[model samples]
Target chain A: MTKTKKDVKLQQPKNQKYAGKAMTKGRYIRSQMKRNWVGYVMVAPFLIMFIAFTVVPVVLSILLSFTSFNMLQVPEWKGLDNYVQLFLADDLFITAFSNTMLFAITTGPASFILAFIVAWFINELSPRLRAFVTLIFYAPSISGTAYLVWGIFFKGDIYGYVNGWLLKMGMISEPIVFFKDVNYIVPLCIVVAIWTSLGTTFLSNIAGLQGVDRSLYEAGAIDGVKNRWQEAWYITLPSMRSILLFGAVLAITGAFGFGAIVDNLCGNPSTDYVAWTLQHHLVEYMGTRFEYGYASAIAVVLFAIMMGANALVQKFLSKVGE
Target chain B: MAVKKLRVRGHRVVLNRSKGGDVGITVMLILLGALMFLPMWYLLIESVKPLGERNITPPLLYVMKPTAQNFIDLFSNINSTWVPISRYFFNTIIISVAATFGCLVFGSLTAYALSKIKFPGRVAMFKMIQWSLMISSTITGITNFFIFIWLDWLNTYWISIIPVWASTLGLYLMKQFIDANISDEMIEAARIDGAGELRIYWQIVMPLVKPAWLTLLVTTFQQVWNAGASGYVWSEQLKTFNSAIATISGVSAGAASAGSVVMMSVPIIIFIINQSKIVETMASSGMKD
Candidate 1:
């Protein structure tokens, strides 16, 4: 690291980013630190807050996962007990886990593909039209209770839009209890989830599509690229590789954090736990159950799943346009 | 962008593009767009629908007669809540403004330093941030509760506001934007011209990266604005408009839908106003790692 930086510095001594005094790398770093103490000061507020909120919590969660502790009592060490209970003894965790995986596998890829395909499809429109389309597709994700519109649409009454329409069309005799019925909960949740899933990933995908260089297409044409699909596969996706990866990461995070939408739409601990996920499971353990250690275990498993999925996505994304 | 050649808009026609393909893509976009849009359209229509129209069979897609009565009723219900409705608005506004402003200031300060200054431990700090992005905050819900307790922040406005200020997303976006748009030479020249780091940041760097921080503020504000039912704050007086709306929703369905419209409109409007800038910031959102 030091060698490459020094080499770059030497190559462009004109605007030396780090003007070292021929000292060892350690001494050089120290001198740089001394010269740029303001940088540390600038970073301190955010770093302190970030560490307190983000970093410390993850560490504490991992540590607490091994120990049984409620808010009132001292944490008791019970290595892997939480895990044992989660995997072996706890049926709900398994249910939540399966539901989480089902939600992730379905909503994660669906959102990703929908975001990309829609972004690509709308990329050709005029700028005004594009933004309007973006507003339509992206608005649901940002709006806090917009997904709850689905609750009303799927409300268990003849007045409910779906039920009303179905009755008018004579497709069904009575309004289906879409939010509560076990058969409908999973599919309904998935639909609502996807409806609201075009969020950060979707926005990033749209930005990325717009940011792709026009020259790439011109060159593709010269190289005899035939269609939009080939152009996207060969040029667009590869050029926006980092953007695609960013989108994928957002997708993973959003997929696993599917609790709020479900909780809002179908009610928490939805009928028979049909739409329960690790997110709801995590909150339930932490808040209601007071199983701090057990909840931390759930969190650890979720953390592992999300990170593993992200790593898998990174690998899979690396193969894009190959 | 280079202005090297005078080109028409929507440049770079791909080879052998088909009219049929164009028709298919447009159809898909509209169909999918309509599907994505219908529910929200329903909500907006619901919000405007008079109470009489609200319970109509098959609930009319278009309102026969629009009324702001639902909104007025929502505000009336809010006013009659245990706490003064102003308190909820106050809590939401204060938290949203403070958190959004704090993150923008602090995140950009850090972003400016990381992107422009050559400092020790910078790489590690940034790498840790990138890795932190891999795990969502839901993973840390239990631990954050502990921290809030440890810091004596539970049941206070501070708990609701403070944690949001440290979100790495805003910082990450700002750093990437600064790195791509601003140059080291600019900062070096500013330094040589006798400007302090703080002055350079506020005057030179901040103004140049307007899109980034604006993007940050808009996104952060949206999150903070929509916050509902924080486990931290127990006092009714300390709740937000969003949480208050949840309470109001219980008493009247029309008022509830109206409340949702009111809640969702702020962020949507903010995004629309700053959409281009947000897009600009996100254009550099991609990172290799």
Candidate 2:
């Protein structure tokens, strides 16, 4: 994420060569610092709070993952016992792990591609039409507990919308217990997850579509870009790669951390832990069992998976426009 | 419409042979939109439907008869004698508003310094911020809860509002917007006119980045609002309306829809009103060519 700024830094040496008398790097940095005291002052508020809440907690969580703490007493260092227990002993954690991976694999790319395609299609509309369509796609994400309404739609009994309609059409004599049955649980949760996945990433992609320079299309046309598909591949996709990559990062993180939607749509710890995610596992230990160290270990595992996925995406995205 | 063509650099290429293609795309968009909208639409209708119709065989798409009875029952049916729905509403409103306000102000402040100022360690600080994004909040969830407990703020509203002030995404967006639009020359120009940094930020940068801040406002508001009852608030009266709604929704189908309606109305309304502006601001949110 931070490497995006490297290109700008690369250009500075060209400007530095034009100076008649070049100062030492140390002196130049000191001069820059002297003039930018207000800059530090400006950032202090958020920086202070960020360090306290985010930075400190991350360190503490990593440390806590190595120890056993129940919050009432001092933490006892347990080394790899928490991790061993998480992997080998806890059956629920294994269920949550597989479920989370299943979710991430299925929903992550699905939503990422869906969001981009929808954004691209919406970009082709007239401005007013574009805004309206964007809102329609975005509405699902912002509507809190709206997926719970899907619970009504997929309710296990005849009262459910899907079952009622299917039953009326004579498609099925019995109502499918979508959330309760293990067979339907993952699939149903995936559908609702995709619906709500058009979130911040979708918004950013729309912004990215809008941010594309109009001149690039003109240039592409002159370069023999023969069709819309060609134009998108050669011009639009490359231009918006940063936002595309940003969306991918968020999507990967969101997919791995897919708990809220499942928790809301299906029951928490879903039926027989069919839809339980690593996040649900972490919460089970953190919030319910109060096994802080074990929970931290679960979190650390989740975090490691996310970082790996992020690295993979970064590598893939760096190849964009190549 | 408009010949269904792309006019690129005076090279007008008709992308579609017939008007049917446009209609087909439009129809597809509408279908997808309806799919996206079905749950919310159902929520609105179901919330008002009579309780009998809610669980009836072959559920009605459009309510034959609508009543506010469910909404009435939602508030009236709470078993708890002490905590009213209104108190949950109050707690969420105060927490979300305060937290949103703080996040915007502090986030933008940090972003301004990082984006516009050539301060030492600015890059390092931003890199740190970016690194934080890789770690999910769940990793820190226990630690935060423990911190709140140690501070003796477990049940207090401050636990909900305070720790959330440092918004990484907000800072990123603001920095991107400020870098693209708010130039150092503008700040220097203001400084030459005897304007202080604080005055310059308030007077100059604030107006320029109103669109970006508004975008941040919607996102941060939605996050905080959805975070109701899920966070550190344990007290009955201190619980957020969303958490309350979560429990209430489990009561019955009608009550669940009502809870959905109640939980969603504010953010949805806010999004509707600010939708266009948010879209416009997004054009400035990322790096410029």
Candidate 3:
């Protein structure tokens, strides 16, 4: 029995070593596979969605732009005709381009300046008061309810709230046709845009301003920076540069995406000063005429424009950082 | 001693003079706030006014005699045979809630993986998410619309809810919170106890990311609520509350205007009640980053 037990013990170590080496190799392969498998599993939904919804659609739209396809019939190949027509023939396209430029120029800087000033003011307030006032300013932007009420306030008729008030105050003898008039369309929209835009950037800027180190302000004060304005210039503005740039990008993107307000306020595209905006044309083609090919061309142009704008902004921002 | 006392008094006067400057600042801010609130307030007050009384000169700042008729009219008009107002509300509620919930869940999960897991190409994935922000959903809307057409999803709920599920903003924000608040030790401990990564995320990490989850919830809710385009395309059975109001009010000349007023004001009224909380949360969280 002793001899047999010794033999068993000696064989056991050799067998154990063999098993251990094999198991280690298996475990390594399994873990490596598991790691990649899990990673891919976690990201699968996003990839599927991004491809099906985003990447696929973008490619299809580009293809559709080259074809003359209405919803009723299959798409037929049409070379650069749509593009040529848009550039040379479409009167409304030029109007839209100019109008979009005007919108970008005006609303971009205007909203930024307003949000900055508001943020600066809120920064000076006590914490609780600052929170309260910030909420009040942001309320307009987030609430769909605000837009509902705005629609009523700017109603074009004499009985419309603004017209009635103006007439009653003897500011104007007759009710101003704010919505119908071509002259007032862009300006009125800009004002409305500014009102809605106050919340997002205001909150962001205020948050950015708070990140400015307190010691910087103390140092400036020691150097005879007698007031908040001087402290803001020397300390707050420099510290909040990134936030400012982020806000500007957001503003630019928002200006380009100005469709809902314009559609709601102005009943038809023809009456709109900026009727040639990609959104307007695409909606018109889709809804009324069903000119899918032409609409796709318009969309492609707009997409290119948006991408170009984004690149330019990115370049400008990077330059600012440098 | 007398000369020193006079100089001290003069310094006090100079300091006191700036007290007026503070008042000027206060007045200026108050005016700006008023300007911001004016249009919204005007809309609400006018919505409550009787149609005949709407044209009052200098406008009625306060409703002299408020009526429930507008609300009553809106309800009755919606119930009419021409438009399915109740169905539209249901559709909106479903889409918005589903989309918001999906964003929170999916965003949190992806964020957890990005934050906790150390793997190859992780940084590349993070950058991809950031770059996605530059690609506006508006630019993709047309393409998405066509893709849905191919998928036979037109006039379906999936059209609205699916596209919004992969929100890069929500993912970015969630990742930020996880980085700030959550610790790697917690995950290691969970793993040591034989808890799976999914279990760790569900049982431990989720609770810690509540603030970010809530913020994303509110923002997503707001976005979905104001959504006109997606629903306009996807669900033929669906008519948004706003669209219904616009259509009804735009078509009907006289009695329908009051109904339109109610429909329009309902969303705003809901907003005013929750505005304080929403704004405060947004402001605080916004400052944190």
Arranged by lDDT with the best first, the candidates are 1, 2, 3
Tens digit of per-residue lDDT, candidate 3, span B175-209? 75676556686676566556787888888777655
TM for chain B in all models?
Answer: 0.84, 0.83, 0.75
Candidate 1 lDDT, B1-289, residue by residue in tens: 2323322346645355689999998898889988988898888888888878767787788989899988888877766788888888888888888888888888888888888888888999998987788778789877887788789998888987887878887777777656755667777766765689899989887866675566567668878887756867888888888898878876677787888888888888888888866555544533211
Model 1: how far residue A145 lies from native, Å: 1.4
Residue by residue across A70-174, what tens digits does model 2's lDDT show? 988999999999999888998988888898999999999999998998888787776677877877788788866677778878888888889999999999989
| Among all candidates shown, the one with the greatest DockQ | 1
CAPRI tier for the interface of model 2 = acceptable
On lDDT, the candidate that comes out on top is 1
Q: List residue ranges in candidate 2 displaced over 4 A.
A: A1-23, B1-24, B75-87, B180-209, B243-251, B279-289
Model 3 chain B: which ten-residue window has the lowest total lDDT? B1-10
RMSD of each: 5.2, 5.9, 8.9
Q: In candidate 2, how many Å is residue B213 off?
A: 2.5
Better of 1 and 2 by lDDT: 1
Over 4 Å off in model 3, which ranges? A1-37, A71-74, A116-120, A123-131, A143-145, A148-155, A165-173, A199-246, A270-276, A316-322, B1-25, B78-89, B176-211, B228-289
